[model samples]
Structures are given as C-alpha cells and as structure tokens.
Target chain A: MECMTENGGYAAGCRENRRDRATMQSVIPDAIEVDDIAKQFGEVRALDGVSFGVARGTVLGLLGPNGAGKTTAVRILTTTMRPDRGRASVLGLDVDHDAQRVRESIGLAGQYAAVDESLTGSENLWMMGRLTHLSQSASRSRSKELLVRFGLDDAGDRQVKTYSGGMRRRLDLAAALVHRPSVLFLDEPTTGLDPRSRRGLWDVIGELVADGTTLLLTTQYLEEADRLADRIVVIDQGQVIAEGTSAQLKARIGTTIIEAVFADPASAEGARTLLAPLGELTDADDGRALSLQVNTGPRSIMDAVGALERAAIEPLTLAVREPTLDDVFLRLTGQRVE
Target chain B: MVPARARVRRLTLGWTVRDSLTVTKRNLLTLTRNPELVVFATIQPVLFVLMFRYVFGGAIQVPGEDYVNFLMPGIWAQAVVFGAVSTAVGLAEDLQSGLIERFRSLPMAPSAVLVGRTNADLVRDVFVIALMCVVGFLVGFRNQTDALAFLAALLLMLAFGYSMAWVFAVFGLRAPNAETAQAAAFPVMAVLVFASSAFVPTETMPGWLQVFADHQPVTAVVDAVRALVLGGPTASYVVTAVAWIVGIVVVFGTLAVVRYRRVT
Candidate 1:
C-alpha cells in the first residue's frame, strides 16, 4: 500500500514493480511463458492479449470461471492451437517455430479425459509412449510403471470404457507423463471428480510438485487453487484481472472476515446496525448470516464481539476467518467463481 | 555427412511413417475388441449381396454376362464406399471425445491420425469384401477371370475405398460429432451409390442419367472391377478409374489435412 504513494500511483507502480521482477527473472526465463497472446473464433474473442509466466518447478494456478480463456491458454501453450497474435514458449523453445520440441517438453491433460476408451489403460499409455518416440521395450516398461504409479495397475488390462471417471482421469494424466515432460498443463483436471477422488488427485499432484515438476493448473475451484498454488492468476472474460499469491490476492478484499450468524433476520439486522462502524459488513443469505471484512488483524474480532455483547443480542455462531480466494474473485470480477 | 536440415527432415519422415503405423495398430485393436462393430460391418454387406442377388436379381440384365456376375462387382464397390463412412464416424468420435486434441499435442506426426484411420478402414473393407465374395459364390455368382485378375479387381476396389476414406476424413473433421458425421456422409454416399451403375447398368438408364452414370467415379471403379472379374476389355475403365482415385486422393487428402489443422 505504501508503494502507491512512493511510486506515484497504484496501476503505474504495480506495473513498474512487475517489470522489475520480470527483468530480474529474465536471467532464468520461466519454464512456460505466454506473451500477449490473442485468439478469435468467428466473432467471439476467446483470448484477448493474455500474458503470464510460470516459474520452473512451481505451481501457478490459473483461476477463472467458464469462458475465461483458461482452456484456450492451455491449448496455445500445448501447441494444439496457434494464437492469432503474440508468442508463447515452453522450456526456452518458441511454441510456434519449435512446436515439436515444445511438445516434447510439455504434457497436457485437457479439461476432458482424453484417453482412448476402447483401448485398455495400459494400451493407451503404451500408445502415448510410442507416439512420443519411445522404443517398444521402453514404452512397454513405462506403461506398466505409470499404471502402477497412478493406481491403475489392477485395472490396466480392462478397457478404458469400463473405468470410473476418476480412473480415466488418472490414466489420461499418466498418458501425458509418458515422456516425463518437464512442464505439465492440466486444464480442470478435477472438474467432475467426487471429493475423495479430487483429494486423491491433489495428492498425486503434490507428489509431482515434490519431484520438481513445473505445473500450470487451470481450475474453477478457488479452494483447489488455494490448496495447491504457490501463485495464482485470475482471468475473466479473456483478460487477467488480478494475480498474486493466495494470501496476497485475498488481502485485496480484506485481511480477515468476522462472521456472525443469528437465529433470525431480526437479530442479524440488529447486530449489523450495531456493528456498522467496525468495518464493511456483507449480510449473507436470508439476512441470517452477517460478515464483517476488517483489515485490522485479531483485534477486529474482539471489537465485533464487544459490540455485539454491548447490544445484548445472542448470536447463533461467531467466528473469525481468513478471507478466502472466493472473496478475492468476487471483489475482482463482481461474481462468484462458479 | 548429410546436412543437419536434411537429416532432420529424414528423421521426421521416418517418425511420420512409424507414428501412422502405431495409430493404425491402435484403431485396428479397437475394432477387434468391439465384436459388435465387426459383426455389423460384415453383416451389412452380406445383406446387400443377398438382397440384390435374390430380391432384385430376376429383373436386371447385363449385355453378355450373367446378371449375378455383373451384380457382384457392383455390390463390392458399394460395400467399399459404405465402409469408408465408418472412417468419418470414427474420426468425428475422436474429435468429440478430445482424442484428436490429445494426439495433436503430442510430439508425433500431424498427418498420422488421418492416415492411420483410413488405413484401418481399408483393412476392415478387405474383411467385409472377402465375406461378400463368399456370399457372392453361394448365390451363383462366379468370377470368369483368373486368380490374378480377381486379385486385381479386389485391389482396385480397395483403392476406390481408400480414396473415399480421404473424402470422408474431411467430412469427419468438419462435423462436430459422430452422429453429425454420419448424417453428413450418408447423403453423399447415397448420391454416389445410386446415381452410378452400381445396382443397375448405366446403359439401361435414360440418356441424360446414363451420361452421369457412365462418367462418375463409382461407375468407373465398378465397371473396372467388372471388366477385371467378368472377362472384358479392362483398359479404358481401369484408366479412368485410376485417374479418379489419384485425383480424389490428391484433392480430398489435402482438404482433410487442412481441415484437421483447423480443428483445434
């Protein structure tokens, strides 16, 4: 916040700071770099001057709602689609001129499970291995290794059409890894999975990150981004609206939210009126839940508690919670992440 | 030593062939695993053979050969053309399922998917045509030519189907889904199959219709196959048929590859 005054203004100072960092990081360029890329389909602009970079061996979560150009960005980076404008690169190779080399260095698991349903899991992986130029023996061994790693060894012989949604996704991810690519692009990898399956996938991703795999994950779930991302870039309507660490982005709205749920709307209204001076209050559904966003740290909760106590209103629940990525998304885009 | 650029080009060409064969193997494996598909592919041609031979055999006439002899080659040509429709549907299914995107993102050859799919369909055509020939034999249709000539007829039919596969490959990439691919391909198939001399003699048709029926590629291929099989002067029909096949392979092969590039 002080940089606003020190560097003259908000937008200019932020841009200057980013330029400085980018210059510094240019010593070792990002593993994945997208520079001012744009794409259009008929009349709809799918991606409009979007740019971002992912450092090596770190996770950069691309957060957005549907139609936010996340998949288009992935497609461009994966060399499946070319941008109408601008350039992208993977592992220091230009994606357009050296697309084959770029493909050799990156793996992409698309929004849908792209595994061949008619082929067994092992066969699918083996085919990917062969296509990536692995020898027959190497491909066979890698297929077995990936099936075991993804917990699909027992089901490896069965056709992919027989596998569950989660199993199919795992196989698809494994197929992408057949060449042991350095950079991975997962577009909504857990979109349709149940909670348990999503968690299982997150664990696999965690292990990959631990093994120093650079990942660019696009996700609609703010929780998924918060849980996995070291840095986050939020895009909406084909543009980057905000980007930072989860805590940094959350700080844009407020540091903490003091929430209180009353038994009735009358009690909530009374509490909101009494606590009006504490900070900014957003009344929740049906007016039974009230949340106060306060930049003041722990003391803000004490202030809210003292105010409610002074008013003689008994609330149903009261808790001080850190602001979530959802709050940042709502503040930036004026809509929920959904 | 070879220049680096030439060496890289050679390696790329080598990988293109290898990748195409790998994909062809995958498609053939899928076909084998789905027994119902094999059953239906064979059954439809057999049904066509039986229906035309028994149901419509009595009314049709050829100039010199038995009606069954003329009918068999036409049926084989029709079977091969229809077999190519499955190429369209299969490719469209891959597109809808995101399998094509997956393949495109890999480091493999760009032309492999289309080449592999058409080649696999050609193999399936061979199987279905062989069964149709067996059905043709049981129903009193016999080839008047030697074994080598019969083999040449078979090869010509496969070449015709191969060209149609390239044509449908373009339709598949243009369509949004498998059902749409089938819908778009069938009407064209009907036009080619019926407007030609596949089911009846072009000479028996009215004068204007005969002009089209005589010149269309399907009729040329069918007439070529009939000449090779039923013992006649094969030179002109074979020349025209080969010209059509080469022209279609050049034109539609380019269109299909272009459409594939624009898919994602």
Candidate 2:
C-alpha cells in the first residue's frame, strides 16, 4: 500500500535517513532501549526497574496485567515521562538528554484514543502533521493519504465525536503515522475494541511491521501477543516476570491439557481420579470441572475418556487443547492475563 | 519521496510559532463548531449588562454620570475575567480526554499548548467584550473619549483576560478533571473580579475591604478601562494595569509551563 511515508516512498528511505544519522555517531542495533527504568507516585512504585529492547523492524509485545507499568514504560521511552533512576533511548538518541530528537523519531498512540472530538478527522491529522513540522501542502497531502490508508477517507470530514469507537481508533492511529515515525508505541491499542475491529487494527499493524517499522505494543490480550508479537515480555505488579517468544512461553507450560466438565461435583472427582494416570492434574478450584496436563497429545484425551468410561464415570464434556498464552501467564504470574 | 534533509532539520523559532498558531487555529475551530460554548460564554455577559443596567442603575448614582456609563466598564472587565474560566475548563478537558498527552508526545515546542489555549481564549474574550459593548451602547452607555482611547481600553481588557487565562491554565493542569477545573476557577474569579470596582464604587465599601478592592489587579484594570472610555486620569491606572497583566503572565505562565512539564 506504500503506507510508509504517506507520500508513496519506501520505508527504507526513512530507515536510511535514520541510519545516516546513526552512523555519524555509533550504530544502534535496537530501535528502542530501556535500562533499569523506574517511576513512583508518592507511595506506589508504578514501574520498578523495567528494562527491555526492541530490535529494529520488529514488534515487541509488552504483556502485563493492569498496573504492571506497561504504560509507564511506554511513556518513558516515548520521552513523555522521565524515569526516576534509569535511562532510555529511542533510535539511538537518549530520551532524557535528547528528548527532542527522540520525539521526532517516534509516534505514540496512548491507551486512550487521543484525537480531539471537536475537530474533523482530517483536521486532527492535519494538526498532527503540522506539529511534526511538515510544510502546509505536505501536511494536507499527508493527512489525505493517511485518511485513505486507514479507511477513514469516507468519514474524513466528519467530527470525531460522531465517529464509532473503531473509527476513532483508526483516526488516532493515523494521527500517530502522520509524520512517519520510525518507532511506534501503541499502549493497549486494541483495548475496548470488538473482535472484528481488533482484527482490522492487527492487520494494519502487521502491514506496518512488514514495511520495516519498529513497534513496541502493550496489550493485556494474550492471544493478541501470541498472534502479532515476535517477542513478548510479561509483566506482573511492577516487574517483568517472564520474557520470550509466544512458543517458548507456551512450551514452558507443557504440550497439552485435558479439560473435563462433569454433570455434578461428585462425577468431577471421579473423573479426576480415573484420569490420574494420564499426566499431572492441575488443581481445579471449580468443583464441577477438572484439568489435567497431558504429556501425550490428542491420544491422551482418548485415554482419559476410555478410563472414565471403564470407571463408569459419565463426563458432561471433555476436550484436548494446546496451552495458550493465557495458561502461560497464569502459570508465570499466578494471575490471569485478563 | 520525503526529503531526508527536511526531516532532520533542527526546529527553528519560526517553526515553533507556526506550530503554536496551528494549535490555536484548532482551538478556535472547536470553539466555532460548539455553538453552545459560544452562546453560554456570551450570554452571561449580556445578562450581567441587562441586570445591572435595569435593576441597579435606577438606585445607584455615580456623582455626575449615568449608571450605564459607570456600569459599562465594570461589565466589560467582569466579562473578560469570567471568559478566562473557559481556559481552565478547556485545558482540563484536554487533559482528561488524553489530548494533552498526545500533544506532549509530539515533537512540537512545549509551550505551544499553553500559548495556543491562552491565545484562543483571548480571541473569545475579545468577541465577548465586543458583544457586551454593543449591549452597553444600546442601553445608553456612551463613551466620552475618542476612538483611540476606546480601542486602548479594549486592548487593556483583553491583555488582562489573557493573563487571567494563564493563571487559570495553572489551575487546569492541577485539577484532576474538567468539572474540578471549572470549580477551582470560581473562587479566584470571585476574589479578584467581584471584590474589585466592577459593580460598585470602592469608596462605598467598608474601609478594611476597600483597601483590597482599590489595590487588587481587577480594580486597576477596571479603573483604567473606565478612565480611558469615560475621560478620566488614566496614566497611573494604565501603568498599574499593565504591571498587573505582565506580573500575572510572568508568574502564572512560568508556573503553568513548569507544571505542564512535570504532569506526566
């Protein structure tokens, strides 16, 4: 779609421009780097020495439960908030010492869609473009180009207040892309969106990554991280407890799970005892259901059902499923991702 | 293709100014689109003018002048002060809505948001003042001075309003929400505008209260604007008014900017 520059330029041209500047100094392997960043609000430590790095032209999904400092870290890396005791750099420029340069090289779509409700979609984009120092014609053309790219061209002249939630989100994303920043930060971008809208945004993000843009996205949706992230960092409370690819995280949780739901609490206990030989049985807090970590794949489910049938245990439902990112989060943090 | 040189150029003062103006344009555009805001802002001043001219004008006598003439300047000064409240509410709204965060994340000059907000509200205050002037003229409020003097009076009132906008911008940033920002602005407005020579002569008040009324910034602004419009000694009052305006802008403007930087 030639969406890199909003003016029909390859994304590499912008990368080359940044490379020329980076080479003048020292080359930066990562598009963004955070080291021991900390922030506190009076008595509460919002971010406790969080550190991460995003390799150039890749997506780093920051997975965290609420209050886990994902937004705080994003704010620090975007040069909007200063860390209490550590450092961050974006595109090889120090966020604190060279905040202006860092701001020029990055775009941020905050947890909330931050477009002005009073202005038209085009006006909002035009304002962002101008603020980034694009010339008047450039700003106008870029706004139009972004509107079309984001599928907002039909509603570009409408006030933002009239936009649906998904439309506002797309406009907000378009606003961030107006200046063609090399590194983009989306803080829970798909949050509050329906599944269809979320899928649409995911496609747009995938395209941006394919075009060589570096993205640091924070999301509470484990499935989203698994689907779109090249690497995922899971944070709990105010610290990162686990970091790896989606597969690596899932692998840590084992291969398969045999989930059985019985008609009554008594049958669930009987099913659990009958399926004890299959694999490790995870403690099911719900009396009417039980889950066992099966070492074997689908065959283990058959074994479990056969054993239950032999024991004359009538299970309401039984299935075999792979360990999802949700199970990984629950295992690592002792808390559910959602 | 986008030019690399253009992308990497250092931000100039001209660019900052242009960016600020763009933000200002957005603010004004929003104001125009929201008819209720304009109507509400302008209606208050008109009501004040009508109420004072009809209800209080008959009982209050200002030596040799008509009450409408005496009340016009006061109404204008009061209207400008009240108009500044929108700055606080507007800024707080932007903050609560996350628009401020978006601007903060952008590469524009840090002062652009504050400058743009204050400048746009000043333009609104100008409109409100002109509307009040028309209302005043209809009610037999005549200007004894020349057109230049009247223009100076209007400019001084706008300058005072602009400074008040900065003062409220600080409150807006401190406020947790827009409603709180609006509430926080009221006490300051009342203490400054109502306690002054806006509606009544300072001489008629108690001696202890009169000291504050006569010396406060609003009194100076109102007296200066009144003298300029009604043919009285204006030199000292004009100096005091300008001093108050500049002083407020310096103290509150610096504080607002500092607060803005620390708000993350």
Please compute DockQ, using alpha carbons, for every candidate against the native two-chain complex.
Answer: 0.53, 0.61
Q: After superposition, which runs of candidate 1 have C-alpha atoms over 4 Å from their true positions? A: A1-27, A261-270, A284-289, A309-317, B1-11
Q: List chain A TM-scores, every candidate, in order.
A: 0.87, 0.82
- Model 2 / residue B15 / CA error / Å: 1.7
Misplaced by over 4 Å in model 2 are A1-28, A259-273, A281-291, A296-319, B1-6
Worst 10 residues of 2 chain B by lDDT: B1-10
TM-score of 1: 0.92
If candidate 2 were superposed on the true structure by all CA atoms, what would the RMSD be? 6.1
**Candidate 1, B1-264: lDDT as tens digits:** 111122122237889999999999999999999878778777777888888888888778767878888888888888888889989999999999999999999888889999999999999988888888888999998889899999999999999999999999999999999999999999999889988988888778899888988888999999899989988799998999999999999999999998898797
True-contact fraction in model 2 equals 0.75
How does each model score on TM-score? 0.92, 0.90
Candidate 1 chain A: 10-residue stretch with minimal lDDT: A3-12
| Candidate 2, CAPRI quality class derived from DockQ | medium
Candidate 2 lDDT score at position A113 = 96
Candidate 2 chain A, poorest ten consecutive residues by summed lDDT: A1-10
